[model samples]
Target: MLRIIGFLLFASFFSLKGQNVDFEYIDKVYVPTIKSVTFHPQGMGIAAPVSDVEGNIPLLLTFDELTNDVKRFSYKLIHCDFDWRPSELMEMEYINGYPEDNIQQYSFSSKTTLPYVHYELTLPNRGTRWTKSGNYLLIVYEDETEKFPVITKRFVVVNNLVQIEPRLVIPANASLYRTHQELDFVVNHPKLLIRQPAQEIKASVVQNGQWKNAVTGISPFSFRNQQIIFDYQGKIVFPGGKEFRPLDLRTLWQRTGQMADLIRTRTSTEVILFKDKLRGEEPYFQNRDINGRFFIETQDQNNQLAADYAQVVFNLYTVEPIYDKDVFLLGSFNDWSPSPEYRMIFSPEEKGYILKKPMKQGFYDYAFATRAKKEEKLDFMETEGSWYETENEYQIFIYYRPFGARYDEVIGYQVFNSKR
Candidate 1:
């Protein structure tokens, strides 16, 4: 019976490949050689991948190619609607310059055992710039054609025309008050003209930039005097998950956080993290985390080119295998998307869930979660427990499509904290 269930899980995950990642618009790396993919505002490597429509701080996209060979890569941005589907608007409508251009800025690795090339591209550079504010997908491909995409990432361009007043609300339900958090917010657009304030104004609330758990296309709860409110009783609630477990791989010389053993080779380094435990039954303890984000850096070098990659082996020790669900590693490094590559398999001999992944030297924050065999939604109660007092980052995006607008316009964006 275990074998039969395992087969079903594997088959379902593999079926997602039929979407053809080369054309799919998502935050994913299609090639095995790409590592440490990040898209964020310029000068701020750890910020969420959001930029103002004014283009003062262009979005920066960076990645490491785990090879020495030089490859010609070109990139393009696709304007998407509120739901992430391509707007299908002409290229001239959303882009100010050429729709596609080559990625010419890169640096080769220096004094590192594992050779890699660091590539950087700033949006709104000399080549291309965004003309409209909305959802966007950055596609990097070979030979100037998106049909051979190597990586894809999602970023947002917003032109602030409204004010978002967000407040973290405690759930009123007895069962949810201790484990869940909710958002109560309002949008006031004083400058923009709107015919249907409740019908046209929509909102999306995202927690920790993870779209898998985001509430999208939300209608206004009430409206009064150019203000739209969203107080969903308990519908806009999220698990107040505990602070992510910290992992420090800044250097291989000294022991770091959770590093049980380190094996160094002439060409590579391997890390074995101490076994992780289920924290659901334990009381929540306050800890510092990057809010589930990672930044690539090395103490041994001044720049990113000298950072090395390590094969990390993670072991999660559960009382027994979760026979009904599949486990996966969740973090900003993978855009919090659970896939076969990040899935943890149960090891009989080790009596735990184990996953091996190659990651660049950096400070990372991560947690483990599970997905049911028949559903895509992930649950965290089995590994990292939830608590109402946990600190978390919330991103609120307000999109407008007044009556005749062809595409959704991102009129407001806000990033706030629960404990603030």
Candidate 2:
């Protein structure tokens, strides 16, 4: 009787874990059970990807579950085009091995108040590999049917065959001089002959390694001497957001960088961060920043796989809440997309906004932002200041879809920094 009850409870949990996944976005976590999800090129930090196509480098996928017991999870890959849409190829055409595989790597957190399991998997494992170079979506599901996925994230598989020359500088327009930076680039395809370069070539530009505001479907302004040049003044301008605020939660024994206080109890530990204020009117102070990217690291544990979790409390200072706006704590730690989970609530008693969230032990960079009611745009300048001289990273991607081809192929990629 006890065995049957245990089996039923296991089945019930798996049923709840099966949630529909949408592939339209870049980083998405479907199930509420999952937390602290990260996917990137192994040892390359968060913004860089393994660019080699010969299987010399592999990608890493990691996540944690709130439950104490371990669970079975499987993952599959979906090939996408340069525009992040599904490609025109079949599963067998892109994947050299099986389409789906199990996640065999995981471990439980050690010497921590929060009891949970951390799972890590590598892409192009022994049973799975990619045959093409382009965009990809890693879909993680709880069952073999794969009817619903618990998490989905986008990754790049690059085969750098073409050279790209990129430049970052102040914008030519005087109006945007104090707030924006400009990007210029040239794509040189010496080995591959692209007929009708204007119609076949597509260019995309991303700021701070984020896809929310990436400029895509751009054509080159000039084509000369086997070089496609993109020097548009108005189209390539990006807002230079101020330096990101850092928070350190790598240890619990003593307060670390930017930590206001640390509270410990029998069940869990909470780290309260110092109150932050609006920087809209502040001058542009040059400080070291990662261009809005974060990496997971821990000093308490020997490795990140053994790191523990902590409940982090973030405080924002304000005399009173804005009448028609809502504030959010945004950063790469939350995929730079502010959902309701990261929304800040006004504390009338404290006269500030407070957001308490569970986070892994690591160094995180974040910013405060505001959005008006029923609005889709987030106003970073309302909280974190924007300046033209602020250092930022820009990445340029060149794609080609020939007249006979059915998929968009990445022909060139280049990264540059402004005032680095």
Candidate 3:
């Protein structure tokens, strides 16, 4: 019975793929060209001219047919739901080639200076409105018939007023510091506080890791230019209470000797293990009876040499194996998938589950989620720092430039103050 259900599920998944349009050059060149192109000040009801060269108007595309004469060349802009599913928000614009038609079109005459194309479109004010601020794609198709190459460009539309900018402060000149050393930096403007209630702040730090919570003893400091002090006196720990550290350019060279040796040895077996040992001895593996292993992996196919995949390995221990157990690995690694990836069986002897996934090479904050009957809990053994629930510090930067100006040639900038 289970086998029959599985086969049906597989067939349904493949059937969905068949419904998609088969535009040969869609993903190859068109997608890249759209992505490489940029638009300024993007948002709802916002319109900005598209340009390839920074200051000038964008060049109209011109295509020459090698074999057959090109007929009825046109384009359309399709807006779908957040998931790109069939949405009421979708709209199509006709790009007519010559002005002779009542429909908008580009005309070429003897006076035409260059062989090019031009198009302009204004999105409708009505229909399903964009509710959330996020990244979206603008798909440009050469022909409404879906026969020619189609291009897609990704853009961000921020609909909300609240903005958050976070920054990390390390010593400007010095790089190396002894393990468990105390460091201090000033948090200026609307002073930053440990994200915890005043009375329970200390207890939270002790229960979680010290690094997870901001250091205490900050009240005496003035809010005008608040000072933040961090004490790494216990052991070297990754920030943001993440289970694994990102192997990016900044920290790649830092992994040395025993750490390097461990990664080299265990990479094929489990590539996500961190080499440097934490100061006090603690059991690294958990969920033994649950039959699971947690680890990290990268998503990038090219540049496997660079840190890309960070995943968790799960080893299930039960004889009457649990089927379809929704195991979620949470850490600073995943954005704390309120819900995350499903488990997969790797090998028979390794009869547990693995959540091997790729991550970009950068520091992240994450945790794990497991279900027992009807309740959910975080793996405290793998968790660090307590959520004090206090206001944290954040930095704000505003960069401005005129329409026909270079990005770096900033006309002005402003910094807003915030506590947390």
Candidate 4:
């Protein structure tokens, strides 16, 4: 009886673990030790993890494991709906070649106190290729009987069946003209028979590749002569948050302007930045930034294996701690997620919020944001003010799924910038 009960319990554990995955828009790290997960098109260090369906443009996937022992890892792709839910199509409908393949590339860290292993893989190799054009969730898991999930990243595959013309404009509304930017666009599906566009078509607008706050389920305003118009003046608006704060950790030997101290120990290095003051009320000034992006690099070593990890300490000085809302650090390094893992702790002694996390050697752009309890929406107004002059990237994705379709097809895609 004891043996049977133990076996049943073990089976139940796997069943539950497999059922509770929060398949969402942002990158997810199931294992705590996995750090610095990045997925972008090859050669483009800071770009959306999007690729053309026929370009054979492989994406670069890389991450580091804190443990010393190298482990077997494999990846599989799952088709996702426009809202990021798993689609009805089976795995074979979207992916060609083997369903899962072993990750054959990895290297151990060198010349660093914190021992780790770096893994890099160019996607769409001989092992696997994609056949559909839509949102996909790439899940990396252990190549074992249990198939434990290690990390998951979101990306898009566009078929380019339709052409999109998108542009950014200053909101005509006097109230929002200076603080918000508006988007106007048209989708020309000359090749596609887009009937019932208001009911059959939906679109999503993302700011800087951040899907967490992306505006989804928007339908076209009008359809005429195979052209779809999206003219939601005030409805299609985004807060023009100030430029991202820059952190230059490219070289630890020489401190940067905001860097307060660099502490080197026998095992690891600590990069501390001088306390940051709240800038919500300050005037907007032109500042150089990567629009909340990061690129890994080690100036001294010049390779992934030689790039060491560091404990980055962030100190935000606030006059009074926000008693009602919680603050978190947002950056491309962490998929701009406002999760508890990036949550800052309030230190009454310092009268500010603080957080520390492990980061690979790189130049990073980040900003502090706040959110209310039990809310997923983040507020940057308390920490960083909004300005129409802020530079930002906009991604417009158009999905089409007629009656009885199994999945949403990304027929049109375009990128727009607010700088101009």
Candidate 5:
């Protein structure tokens, strides 16, 4: 009797364990995962495949209790801004293997453990037209009778092309070895061509070495035409008075060859901000109003310094004396950090904050920020590098059809222009 009773208890425990492990939750439903993501030859387009295996995008999901009731499953595509904020692009939805309206509905059975479903959608043809380019999240929600699970992933789109012709300039009486170089260009897109009138167009030069300063101007080329010409001047001056020779230009350009290609494909108007400030008597500041200035420079195609650095001077304001205050010049230049490399200091005689560190030639976005809890403030007063709100150009591209289809091979490409 004792042996039989012990055996029965052991069997009961085993059975309970099996049942508990098999239980499921609605949130645990398997999400159709996109495995390998790739782009065509020039990284001009994007592609991804969904599959279940190692070396693939993994979808680990669980579902609630099983039932034979669910007959089918479907999906919907939503477009969002660079920050994943919902935008006007959501009106467009394209799904594979289903009617447009029927795409959001799915048929499934509760008893089915693993059902096979494959769907693909292509974005409309607009080359580098996304107003902003950066990181974007794609959310895929499963359709079920009850609330379904959601899967999210990230992808990048870029538009860095410059439509207007760029010109090179060398300042007269400037030392070839010691003086900074500059490049200027204009955006000639017609007013009717832009989606937003408030958007500002920006021009930047690429160079081999670091740029010491940069500047840009925009105005109506003529009073009557309503047409505007943008002038971009960039300069690169070696720090500590060390002259940059022509040979150095060759090596630098070769190392940065991919820059042009990246600009062409991923250019967008997405603006990121960085800010910093310095007070009187601080290490890097000058006076109370005239703060330190900042700028960027880059290389051109001929292995010579292409343009002068774009310059940005920060304006400092008088504030109540506070001790141990900290300020930073934050932006894409210093990896968007408030570190010693990008710190700003005050100069009492000069009445401003100063940036003593020399920056390499390139386009940069930066702003001012303070550390004191009471003094901490976001400074929009002094603009550095390039302002984000300026009108910029973008290109969009749409690649359609499955990867293996012979006739469907990358069948579509288009370009759209957005201003603001």
Candidate 6:
């Protein structure tokens, strides 16, 4: 049964190989050496998704190469439709400047045991600027070749043609009331005209800053007063996931918030975190969390471009090893995507699961996520637990496709917090 289920899940992901766009990819790196990758609005952290096509706001792309030597890296942009496939528009139609450019801004790690080169690039600069408001993919590759991209991150550009007002409520379904949160929104398009609310207008909603399970292809059940309403009967529901687990790596010199031990060596520094508890047995408790977002901060330095990196070690103890599922340390550090580096391996000697990986110094919010080979859902039941009152962030995106248009335009974008 598990094998069959696993095969189905694998097939579903790769089925879009020839499709125009893929939204399932959150933040992914093609190579193993690439770490501490981040792509967001210049001053905004990973939580915010506001970018202006007027060149008022630019995205800051940064990543670290573990290799000792520096390499020439280049970047390009792909304007995607609302579905996240490459749009039909050509390069000159969407970009004002050249299509591609080399990343000239970078710095080497300072006063750290792990020698690496950090690269940073601001999007829509003088060399390249966007001309349209829609979904986009920022790809980074070595040298001038576009064959194999080292990193691919998604971002959005909005011109704000419409206004979005969103509301969160307990799901109408009795079975999901305790563990689900539903979204109801209204899109007011005063200037833009939509021919069909059901077919021409499309909406998507994402919860807790993760796009893995975002709800898309939303259709309005009713329209009135020049507004489309998305108050679905039992749709637009999301898991009221528990508050994220916090890790404070701002400073490594001494034992910090959750630091169990800090081992210093001539070549590198390693940090050991205390064991984590399984929350399934306990009642739900509300805690302040960053909703799975990450922010870069260095203790000795203010500029994140030159922040020191560390080899952080994570330990999660279990009474007995569960052989059916795989445990992973999930967060924005790896774009909330599953990878071998963040997987925890069970150890009989310690009676726990352990993982040690190199990460840039920062404050990160993560959780222990378990996935079965054949299962489609990422279960937090045994680790983080589900609760209705867990504060989560939600984003509403509305895209419109005119009758004669070739691509979907982002007519409206808004983000709201459920706790508020």
How many clashes (backbone N, Cα, C below 3 Å) per candidate? 0, 0, 43, 1, 99, 3
Task: Specify the highest-lDDT model's number.
Answer: 1
Candidate 5 lDDT for residue 387? 22
Residue-level lDDT tens digits of model 1 in 87-184 = 75656678888878999998999878889888989988877989899999888987634348888888899999999999998796779999999999
- Ten contiguous residues with the weakest lDDT in model 4: 16-25
Candidate 1, residue 334: lDDT: 88
List candidate 3 stretches off by more than 4 Å: 1-87, 93-156, 159-261, 265-327, 331-361, 373-386, 389-420
Structure candidate 4, residue pairs in collision: 113-267
- Please, what is the whole-model Cα lDDT of each candidate in the order they appear? 0.87, 0.80, 0.28, 0.84, 0.29, 0.80
Task: Report the C-alpha lDDT of model 2 over 48-155, residue by residue, as the tens digit.
Answer: 553555667888888899878888898888777778877777676788888788899989877678777899998778899888877777888887355567888877
* TM-score of each predicted structure versus truth: 0.92, 0.92, 0.28, 0.91, 0.24, 0.91
Over 1-420, each residue of candidate 3 has an lDDT whose tens digit, in order, gives: 999987986775445333335432111224211211222332311122122112122222222211122234333333222232323321211111221111133322111111222233322112212332222334444543554444433322322222222223332323222111122222222332323222211100111211123232222222122222222323222122212322331133234221222232233222333322221224322111100111222233233223322232333233333343344554422213224343333344644334555332333333333444355543332222312121222211111122342221111111211111
Candidate 2, run of 10 with poorest lDDT = 16-25
Question: Which tens-of-lDDT digit does each residue in 1-420 have in candidate 6?
Answer: 999987986675454233324223345787888888877788777655558769788788888998678888887777788777777776767888877788999888776777778889998888999898888887777873444578888788888888999988778999988888888988998887777778888988878657678898787878986899988868998878888889888887778978888888787788888888887666778888888888878886666555667778787889787669999899877877767777899988877888888877888998888999877577888887787777888888888888888777887889899988
Residue by residue across 1-420, what tens digits does model 5's lDDT show?
999987986675455223323212111223323211111212222122111112122221112212234323332233333223333322212122221122222233211122212233232112111223322333344444653434333333333322344443453324442222333334444432333312332222212111112121122232113333433222311111111111011112233321222111121211111223332222221111101212222344332122211123333433432246666665423323355655666766645565544223343333455566455343322222222122222222211122232211111112221121
Ranking by lDDT: 1, 4, 2, 6, 5, 3
| Superior by TM-score: candidate 3 or candidate 5 | 3
Which pairs in model 2 have colliding backbones? none
**Which structure is stronger by TM-score: 3 or 6?**
6
Better of 3 and 6 by lDDT: 6
Put down candidate 4 lDDT per residue, 1-420, tens digits, no spaces. Answer: 999987986775455334526444358777779888888999999888888887477899999999889989987787889988777766667778875788889999987778888898777888788888899888888765677778889999988888999888779687997788889899998888976898889999999888777888999998899999998867788888899999887776777887899898787789888998888898888887888889988776766577888898999998688879999999888777787799999898877899999888888999999999988888998799899888899999999898888899998888888875
